[model samples]
Target chain A: MSAAAARADAGTAVARVRGLRKSYGDREVVAGVDLELFAGECFGLLGPNGAGKTTTLKLCLGLVEPDGGSIDLFGYDLPRQAREARQRVGVVPQVDSLDPDFTVSENLLVFGRYFGLSDAQVKARIPDLLEFANLSGRGDAKIQALSGGMKRRLTLARALVNDPDLVILDEPTTGLDPQARHVIWDRLKQLTAQGKTLLLTTHFMEEAERLCTRLSVLDQGRVIATGEPRALIAEHIEPQVVEVYGDGVDEWASAHAAPLSERCERTGETVFCYAHDAGPLVASLAAWPGLRHLHRPANLEDLFLKLTGREMRD
Target chain B: MAADAQSRRTVARASPWRLPAFSLRALHVWRRNFLVWRKLAIPSMLGNFADPAFYMLALGYGLGGLLPAVDGLPYIAFLAAGTICYSTMNTATFEALYSAFSRMHVQRTWDAILNAPLSLDDIVTGEALWAATKSLFSGVAILVVVWLLGLADSWRVLWLVPLALLVGLCFASLGLIVTALAPSYDFFMYYFTLVVTPMMLVCGVFFPVAQLPDWLQSVSSVLPLTHAVAIARPLLAGEVPGQVLLHVAVLAGYGLVAFHIALVLARRRLLR
Candidate 1:
């Protein structure tokens, strides 16, 4: 069974938000969001730019006060008892906010104090946290001297300084290279194994599929769909996709797209053919000899595009 | 009845005045800045001393050589007290504006801290106190210089520490208010030109407020730095300042009122 399936239904609700609403001027950033975060599960919020992912994360933390609705985190009321709730929670923001003046470990040491941890307590945890982030001997390295990936790992370690039960990461690997991304994903998977509930936001479908047991797709300030990654793909998208691209792809799409596929979409120079059965679509694609085609099983990206639409969102 | 309740909620959310609740958590914020400052303390102190050292040498001694004593004191001696207040004001203002704004907006340090158990109130209070503490350091440093130069030999001069602290607190509070409203570093230029510089000139940093026109002296009396200098100059000369309560009251009032307003504005700016 998937981690989300095993944990979500049986798990206690560590955080609950009902009909949460927030607005900046006339633009409603989080329009009536309802979420229940189960303990020991990595729940993801997937959205394009400005799809209210960051705003929703902020509202959940009580960093932004909601215009309407109620939030209960760790059984404490939000924007009121948020401090108490936050004592048990940790957050890694969308953008890094590491103190450039302090060295790598000093950053963790200082941040841990905000959670009321004694200096000795934080100092004791620093070595292990650094080792966890794979920055063991570089504790004295300044923030500016560290590479982008190293800084992000240090940030992840900093979030774990208090040993918080819930860790919220906003697009933790947005600008990272593949190697760096894999390193962070490995760390996050370990966090879930440690039974730390994680709520993260991301624009990467592969990241969501790899790290999250379940996730919610947000668009235009609303959740369009929510389910386990595989379940969501199964429910929303066709089982297979044949993407035809290159020269004469449009002509090939016009000739064979409707006749041979369950559904079709055109984006730029490529046409995606979605079908329940891959055999017939693969057979049909052979007739278009000049066009290059790729056949693969549908995944989270297909589900995301299907639910949030193919329009480019900024 | 429901509409009335809804409107009241809006009013409460947008209230202009609020009494801030402070906690010991603020000290952590203070410690954070203290740790950062400790690394660059030597160079930072050098930078703070350079500007005032130039002002004293050129304006205090050079200009004093040309003019007679003003207000029963040598031009250098009179300028000494003014330098303490003025330097404290600049130190407090710059720390609260540039450094605090960098932590709040540019570096997103406040955003990170807010996500922790600390509230915005704790962060703002800690910032204001740290700025005041640094200004107190600057003010007392000038007091030590004046003492070594044999400008004032009285025990009454010890009042400079608490007085400098008051001046720091008042100006720091005012600077934070501007920081909460500022969109970027460029916004601070307007504040420096319009509010800070004008007050420095009229509040008798380089000269006596009496040297200005009667109308200008009236303007000077209301400025926070003027009250700072009013108490400081007399105390530095081994005399108790007249209306001591009044001067301290004005400084504290500015500090307290501006701090409250800073909290309110910060809420609007940050807690949207």
Candidate 2:
């Protein structure tokens, strides 16, 4: 789409970026890009490391200035009107920036006060906020005492102290366990149900699939593809995948498996067989002795690999 | 959307100076540090008191006996007024340098504050004011010791409270300026050894600025600590100050300029 057309379409967007670009010295970190985040939708920016997902999120928050382009967040220009836009926004940065000096409850109290909430008002909300984070009894505990998951949860709760309309999370569950991840996802779902808009960045395809209603896949500072998780999978990849692995899969692919599958890809010892129908591929794999294979429908991960290429991005 | 437009218009109408953009929300940042300091009150007080107390006894009484009285007061008493100013400078500078650096970089406290409605100006001003307040604690503590030990000559010594706060602002601003440029903790040592140590000696903290050579005296007159001691010494001795307005103006000038510069540098460092 033309840049002006894209911006015109973003009139109802919570955040709109047109031809956004940022560079550091000789390297362009975020090249020309356009994005529009609608109200009350869970939008995801999915990419591997160095794909500029963090930079894009920072640009949206007005934390970093773009080299070129215009960003209108909540109908206000960024950096210039950042303080105003940020009043209705909450952020959970990729790094842990929680104050360790105060007890868990004090962290919330002080954070709320930053948004101009009075001491009485902040104190009144502490109980509900702590309860929401599942940290009810641990309010008196120091930050040092909380587990990683608990700290992440408290960070989330801290973000909500302002009762923001938009919550931006950068890799919210990057280092979290599965149980903790699920709890966060549930809380995020509740927020969306309450008509809160969410913008999250993650490399985990499963996370994007489960949480985001619409997503943009980024690679090397550009948006490679943008759509709903299932739609992107349906558009870019075959319906089924057969993973054939164990001893001599390379030799088997050259002699037998190559003719049976629509497309084949090898990364190390494993060979992924892509097809519209996995039934035929799975049946063909049964004839090969001692070959272990599994068949399933293609997911967002497959589509991501197809769009961004299968090369490992450090 | 109307609210956003209103705020945007307010921002557009804001003065180019940007210094006055600080908000009362900075008090929240100050209150946060106060709460944290309360937990370590005893140890913090002790650390603030110990250095000046050691200088008072070791250099005041121990070395005073061998030296002549200074400006009609005993050497120890002369040293006492200097110690008050010195202690204030140390407290504010240390708080702004080591403690503030850790909060800004290591602990990421500044980042948390910035995520809210607070601006960079608010956070920087909050830190500077908090450092000044903390310095007051040490300055007042030492003032009490000076009074108890008979080093203070008159009730005018009470004026040291505001003077100490001003000294705190001066050094805090200077220290924060360094912090904005510092890449690591190791960068602070250059400031301590080169700037602070030299200021302590030539700024009339250890002896009268008049006692120094003519060229050195010229340099001493420009130092913020010199003005602090000039005002604080006479207050300790219950005498009227000479060049009071000039001394205050110079100190305030250092504070205001350094504060503006620090805010600009910090905004560049943290926001980008």
Candidate 3:
């Protein structure tokens, strides 16, 4: 929130979606969703599987018609004037779409044509864009030869071929290694630094906390919570977390339940104690010498788990 | 705004058949296919040309030597005319069904293109036209071979260029309709068997429609390929094709109507 806080003059919303609804057969995927993205800020949609994140993203791109809603993107109606609104928007879909038939540079060049850019215009930008993706000299490399990370980076570069104002990514780093994930995060940060608006969806809470200025946690196609990341964490969870686990941690938790911490949760062999401060929680750990404990500040993952149930969907 | 949105959705759900916008942007989609095909053009074009050449030469020389002249023309010459129509139809239909489906479903090329500023209308039209373009190439190659084989040296053959395009359009459009409805590559077998193969046999590609059973002759009259062969057979014989407008109208009608249906079904398939 602090890194990309809204300035005093920030007024115009880049995209405004209200009461969007969509259903497939008898199953309602997106029940009622609303989203508003302001200029030069990264907003995230955090949801578990089947939480309607991809469907919502598709609706914003005008790739799918909403069953019922109003979408005004760049001040134009959607799925109708979607062509015009999409003129200045770049999208990276949930699945990678870098054409395997073409080389890296060819993919970028051909995609630019779809946006009405001439070959010369796209060619001129290919070097810079490839460099941005850290694929400086692999322009002629086949898409089939590139690794997963390279394809992801190329997809990002291809999206920028039009130099779009708003970039929409659906789980940009879902299946990447840690290093690859960091590279994408760095590239996205550069985009934000250049004052580009980003609206993305991710189940990775840390990614949301690091990249999103504001986020909405979606459950069952509904927004359960929407606010600044740290602010939401502060509102929903205690400021500190103490994890205690050892041979007799369960017995120690019951003995010191009321007097020690505000709330506690036991999952598997770990007992998570939540409190406003770590001072008393840490000091209380001395009584149970057989127990091992660790104290740290609360994070967005804690808030997310608190809001969305901890049960595994499958 | 809500009312307007509702009305628009209602309109979309009610009727999807609007006149082709013929948006110039569809050429970008055509260009995409062109760029990809350019890589394999040499081998691909050869395959398209060779398939028909083998069939025509084998059937004409081998089978014609066994039978009397078909309609006062050498069997090879008669088969050559029908071969042009059948070859063009097969090329366009194959490109539309298999190649187009790969880009749409497997390669996800159309999904990538959809993220661009272009609409679904542009993608369908572009793919259908690209398939037609492939057939045109196939038609041209066969035409040149027919000329070399001493079938007809008349200027009348020049008119077949546009006819090839029309036949290509009709079959390509019909093929795209099947593509939109297909769930996988295996689904194309039914189209080839039920639609393409039947049309080839009864549409006078190998023999005259008059030889068909009375019921089939009536059915072949309505088939687009019959008109293509009808015009082509007369053109290869150096004669003015009878009912030129009616034949052209039939082929064009099939192309235009099938194109609209493909557009409609694809909107349901992809846009969902």
Candidate 4:
């Protein structure tokens, strides 16, 4: 809340969105979301798929018009002042958009020019950008020849070509392998250390927990919860989780555990209990034949499952 | 009173316009895809140049052998001017339509551009300039091949280059307007087959519009391509008319108005 309040200061609020409402015909995508992102801080948007995280980012960037809302980016009202707002920001979309025709350095050079950088300045930044994206030796490679990880890194490098004050990355490492993800994470850490503000959206709870200082959990186009990760785990959910495994565990939880636990929920083949201490919960799980399996501390994944149910929808 | 002044000062400080640093972002993007233009150059010329050669070889040589000349000029030369006009149209239209559409929709280069200090207007202007440049190149290619074949009838026909560019401007602007409205590539195919292709064929490309009914001839006279051919065909045949200036004015007007329309549509599609 202090961070949110600090963002109310004119100098701190890099992006502010209030009462955002959007719908595709009768189906509302973003019902009512209020958000403020401060300068020099990282904000992560945590949600399940189809939770309007990308839509919210698109609305802020003026790519999609909201049904109703006001977005102030660097003090400029969107989309009337979209050009002004856009000048200070950079974006890495979920899809790779590096020009297939251009080589790596050429791609960065061209993108920098859109920000109105001079030819000399564009050339000057190429070395640093190539090194930062781990693409220095591959500057001559065509975009079509690059691997998925390479493309993702190049996309990220392209976003920073203009030296933007604010960077928005949507699902930055969704499909990459562990090595690629770690490399990206290291670069992102360096960026944050430089005091450049970031806003990220990801369904990967581990990514959210790893990078974000403050986060919001969104479900069904609504902000279900928002706070620091540790605070959220402490306040709205249990610090420790005990998962009992077996078929008919739901029936067992209903009979033996539901009455004893603070919050006991069931998915297929497993029953989860959220409580202050898993020590007592583990002992309690030994009594029920169906609850033979035991688990340790809970995390954001458990929190996500607790808030958004296990029912599958197409 | 000092506190009130301080609050007023804070309110005044919340202005939206930031200092614009117009870097060379557009030029960098241009250089990145300049090679694509080089690849496109041969294909574009081949695509446009073949139209006149095919019609002249297939229709003019084959059909003209069976029939008399309509207005005393060789049928090859008549079809030659029409082919050049259609070449300009095809080059300008394709560059403005499919290529621009992909950059805006698929590549998301429009997103890349708008993120910089460049506005929607600048994007459209840059695209139009680029398309015109491509069209001019294609026009020159066709003019050269035609002259080498000794089909170019008049020294006055050299003016057809600028006139062809005018035709390109008209089609490119219209094509850009279509690109702004076109949702998918499939949507674009409909306009090309139905509107643009038919307009080229019926607007006196190979045969005289006078052979058609009087009203259809009148209808063809007002279209931008029609004036281009009217001015170009006569010039290519060693004839010049004061009325050609009227054609120039109409083409210029179309370019300006269509350009503005394209800018508005781009702004709506982008900023919204």
Candidate 5:
């Protein structure tokens, strides 16, 4: 579904932004953007580095004041009523903001107090929170003692202490290994199952495809496109892609360049051939015996690359 | 959407002074700091006590024989009151500058707190108050030592507790203002040397400010430590402090103004 269609289907919106704009000096970071996050669905904001994804997330949380825009979260106006809105919201920032001085459990306990939870209330929730994060027995361990994955899980678990109606995660699984990433993904899924709205930003296309029900692709401080992962691929890109590259691959590509697909991308030693049908491309690739190729269905990564371009942002 | 558009139109005209919106929620930030401080309470207390102890040994007794009585009191007795004031300023200033910076920037603790219902004002106020509370430990430690050693001339010395807290708030607020402007740990050297060291010498910590030149005395009179020492010294000597209300008002003025400025600067630095 597109962002608008998804909004129409959603029962109630957790947040809405209209014509959001933010700038740092001469450069416009987030320029004329609109977004809506609904309850019980995972919304993704995908962009390359410096695409203003982080700025957009901060704007929603009232951390960064927008140059020209307004945000309403749970019916409370941003900044003016930011404190009231934030009472029901949880945020796991892009960086590790966990307190190093406190133990793992102490981190949760202290953070709970920020939302005005009493000591007894915080303690009552500690066991369940620690268990959810898979750090049940490690509560007393200092933050430094926990591994990177453990710290990330603790950060996620910390965000849940308030039982927030909405959770905003910025690059939730950026540095984790596959196993740790899968665990976080499962926990996030559980949150959605419990009816919590999730808004996340990620450069990892696979992460977005796996978790996000609907997402907006941002580039150069604008939303270029917004839709479901598979729907976006089917609508914006070819149905198939054959990654062809190896020794003499460039020479062969140049020779049969006329019959090859019109939409092709060359990055270093590899050439990506995009087409509605892969049969002709596969048969033609058989001529280059020594070359290597893999044909697969087009995915969100292809649509993202096509929409945002393949250039490195930073 | 229409309501949102209406709010957006008014946002451009919002007052900049809204940056420091203080609330009672600051107590939570203070409690957070207290919970963390309790983990290393022993080392924390020892560190707070070390400076006052050293000053008493090195300056109070070491120079007692060479320096004559200050304002008709023994050198050690006079030095004790100044030590409490100076220690309060030092403890509060150091805590606000170094530890508060670590929480705000390095550790990103302020960011974490801001994620919740708290605002920048709550965090800054909590930090300033926590620093003052921490400084109280050092002030009280020295007060106890002086009392035991017979350095306190009268029961009026008890007033030093509240005086220490006032002095602590004054310096802590000043230090937080510096923390708001500091870009890195190395930036603190300028604050300690140019601001803190000068206040220490001119505020009559070791020697009477009355001995300084007429113009220097006027300069010292404006310093927060001077007011702290003025009230503290008279109380320690068993004499009623003259112009007590003015001295407190000056200290309070520094604290209130510095606190307001710290909140404003911190909001600008952290929020955008």
Candidate 6:
């Protein structure tokens, strides 16, 4: 189904960012970015650190103003209409911001009240949100006493306290262990299943692959590629990849595989060969003795490295 | 189609009340803060009381026993009023400055609050009100303690509570502005040591501003705390000074403009 149709038949954009830009002094942090998210679309932003994904999210959420261009939430201009727009939007910040003073349930109740939810309305939503976030048993626990993963779950639960239509999450699982990551992914999927819109930023290729339906690959404050996650990889890079690592892989790639394969790129000590099929590439690489070889399906990282170039940016 | 249009209009009309919605959230956070740190209230109150109490005992009793009274009042009454004035300033200033910074930056509390329907103005105004509440409570506590000790002799001293609240508005607004500008906690200490601490000492809270050097008296006249102490001191001594109205007006002027400045800075920090 088209993205718009999947969005609860609302036929409206939940968030629209046009030519958004943020700069600190002379350095442009988010440069001329444009994006649109419809309800029920799980839109992922994939980038390395300092790629302006977080800055873009902050601007869209009105946490920070854009240096240039405009952001609209459900058609309301962001800065001038921030309070109005925020009423229908929720944000799960990269850093956990749960109130250490309140219990998990109190935190939800207080935050829900911020959106003008009455006591009865807030109380009614608590049990479901607690279960969704896996915090049903710890609803009375102090935020300070909760583990990092629990805190992250509570933060996510807090965002939904007001039943926001559009949810913005900035690197929601950056430091989480594998189990924690999956739990969050499940909750996020459930949110989308309820026809809620989501905009997320992540550096983890695997997380984006598992969670995001549509994604934009951003590098140096600009979009490098954007489409459905699978389509972007298939359209831009090879379907299968053969990684050959040795002291002279780059030289070997240039002499042996550059002309034969669709593409050959060097990342660190490994040379990744992109081809429609890895059979010929694997067979060819076996002739070169003492060269390490590993074959896997080409994914977002290959597409990302292909577009952004294989330089050690950090 | 007509039904959909009506629904849209209803949403548009309800937009302006969003800030009050956020302010209510601030009150919830404040209540939660109180619950978590129930032990903190007594210590914080003591901190507010101890400074003035020590100064009053050492200066009013020990020093006054040596020197003659000012305006024919016992040194204890004179110093009790001044101590309460300075305590109000400290209570309001500390809550708005250090505690606000921690909530805004370290805890990321404001970010979460703003994500709801609350505007930047609501967050700041709520903070100012909470600080003012703390100051007023502290001042009243100090008044009761001194009254029990037979230090505050005047029934008119009850007026100091309201006057202290006015002083709180001034310091709370100023503290919010400082919190918006402060980059880190250490920066706040610099403001406390160099700016706020001096304002407390020289703002007619301890000695009469009239006895200060000509230039120092001129400088104290511009401080809101000086005006606060001016009004509060006369009431505590059972003398209703005619110029107290002028002090009230001066404090009101500072309160309005300081709150405006704080709102602008909070917008820059939270939204820009």
For each candidate, what is the lDDT? 0.88, 0.86, 0.89, 0.77, 0.88, 0.79
Q: Looking at model 4, give its docking quality level.
A: acceptable
Q: Give the per-residue lDDT of model 2 (tens digit) for A1-314.
A: 23344335443588887777777788787886678888778999988899898888887877777777678888899877888999889899889988998899999998998888888998999998899899999999999999998999999999999888789999999999999999999999987776778999998888999999999998888888988899889888989998889877877789766787788998777898889877767876666886798788999988888888888887
Candidate 3: tens digits of C-alpha lDDT, residues A219-284:
888889999999999899999898889989878888874467888888788888888866876787
Show where candidate 6 strays beyond 4 Å: A1-11, A247-255, B1-39, B151-155
What tens-digit string does per-residue lDDT give for candidate 5 at A126-207?
9999999999999999999998889999999999999898999999999999999999999999888777889999989999
**Candidate rank order under TM-score:** 5, 1, 3, 2, 6, 4
- State the lDDT of candidate 6 residue by residue for A97-153, as single tens digits: 888767899899878878888879999999998998888888888888988888888
lDDT of 1 by residue, B21-45 (tens): 9999999999999998899888877
lDDT of candidate 6 over B196-265, digit per residue (tens): 8888778876677788899988988898888888888778767896787788999889887878887777
Better of 1 and 4 by DockQ: 1
Highest TM-score scorer: 5
In candidate 3, position A272 carries an lDDT of: 84
Better of 4 and 6 by TM-score: 6
- In model 6, the Cα lDDT at residue B188 comes to 86
Q: How should the candidates be ordered by DockQ, best one leading?
A: 5, 1, 3, 2, 6, 4
What TM-score does the A-chain of candidate 3 achieve?
0.94
- Runs of candidate 4 exceeding 4 Å displacement: A1-11, A66-69, A287-294, A308-314, B1-35, B50-72, B149-158, B181-183, B253-272
Q: Top DockQ: which candidate number?
A: 5
Q: Identify the runs in model 3 with alpha carbons over 4 angstroms from their true place.
A: A1-10, A245-249, A257-259, A279-293, B1-20
The segments of candidate 5 whose C-alpha lies over 4 angstroms from its true place after superposition are A1-10, B1-10, B13-16
lDDT for B64 (candidate 3): 94
Model 5: per-residue Cα lDDT over B44-152, one tens digit each:
8887887677778677778898877878988888888889999899999989999999999999999999999988888998998899998898999999999888888
**Candidate 3, residue B37: how far the Cα is off, in Å:** 1.1
Q: What's the CA error at residue B1 for candidate 1, in Å?
A: 26
